[model samples]
Target: MTKPLIEITNINKSYQNGDQELRVLKDISLTIDEGEFVAIMGPSGSGKSTLMNIIGLLDKPTSGNYDLEGQEVDSLGDQELAKVRNQQIGFVFQQFFLLAKLNALQNVELPLIYAGVSPSKRRELSKQYLEKVELVERMHHLPSELSGGQKQRVAIARALVNSPAIILADEPTGALDTKTGAQIMDLLTDLNREGKTIIMVTHEPEIAAYATRQIVLRDGVITEDTRKGGEI
Candidate 1:
């Protein structure tokens, strides 16, 4: 049988605050298969962001196991984790994190540059992803010159440029108006239909509705996990 793309088991995360331990996540377990579109939903301080960070490899759990493509990741060193993250996970953020100085194309090329792809190949791949995101015409525009939606599109292009196994989006629509947010959700839905595994963090029910599965976190524990058709 094929393994799940991501398998997280008994995950626990905590932080130290002035000699007190603050638990952010408690004994969470989940599996995400390739091509699944999952939304992690919660109110403020529900540990949803912490869970996203662990899944994205930006943070480790205080305890428990995370396996990406069947390989144990909890024990990986920072460098090794970085390498794995670059190769297997692409990130999109609420702020659209594009460099203000770089044009859309250049921003998309950043990942390939870090991966050490040839310059010509990087340009080629970046343009291809920009086209996929329908932002090729704005390739030369800087973040300042683009609209909020356009900036997010560029961020999406950058996320796709690496061809990572999973795309992790944290509050992707938070920075846009309703219409623009819907457009972005449509784009993301299209990408998911094309077989991309998308894991998104959002507090809005409307935004979370775009995903096939919704996992609700409350007070550091998963309160609900539901698929669109029914519970899973």
Candidate 2:
């Protein structure tokens, strides 16, 4: 059998708040196979974001075992973790984090820049992804010049430029109108159909419906897990 793309076991996350220990995630275990589009749903403070951060290597679990592409990662050093993140994970968030000073194409090229890619190659690849997202016409426009949907598209292009193994999106549509949000979801669906593994955190049922599998979290625990047809 092929190894799962992500394997997380007995994961826990905690933070010290004044004199008390606040536990956010509790012994959560999950496995995501390659090409699976999974949506994580939860209410406020349910630990969904914490889990996503751990999966994306933006943060570490206090105690757990996490394996990515069959290799253990929980014990990797900061630099190693950064390398893995740059090579294996792409992130999208509700707030488009594009630099206002940079144009769409330049924002997309940022990751490649950190990866030590040549300027010419970075521009070429960034252009390719921007075109793929149908934003070629606006590639030269800055984030301030684009609409909410357009800005998110530019962020998506930036995320895809790295060719990461997984895309982790948190509240991707929170700031857009229904129509624009639908368009973004369609783009994500198309990417997933093209075999990219996506793990999105959303509170909207309609948005979650775009994914093939849904996992609901409440109070730091999974309460429901369903695939298509409501299969658990």
RMSD over all Cα atoms, model 2: 1.0
Please, what are the lDDT tens digits per residue for candidate 1 over residues 142-175? Answer: 9999999999999999998888999999999999
* lDDT by residue for model 2 (1-232), tens: 5459999999999999999999999999999999999999999999999999989988889998999998899668889988888878998999999999999999999999999999999999999999999999999999999999999999999999999999999999999999999999999999999989999999999999999999999989888889998767
TM-score of 1: 0.98
Least accurate 10 contiguous residues by lDDT in model 2: 1-10
- TM-score of each candidate structure, all chains considered together: 0.98, 0.98
lDDT to native, each model: 0.94, 0.94
Instruction: Report the C-alpha displacement of residue 229, candidate 2, in angstroms.
Output: 2.2
Residue pairs with colliding backbones in model 2 are: none
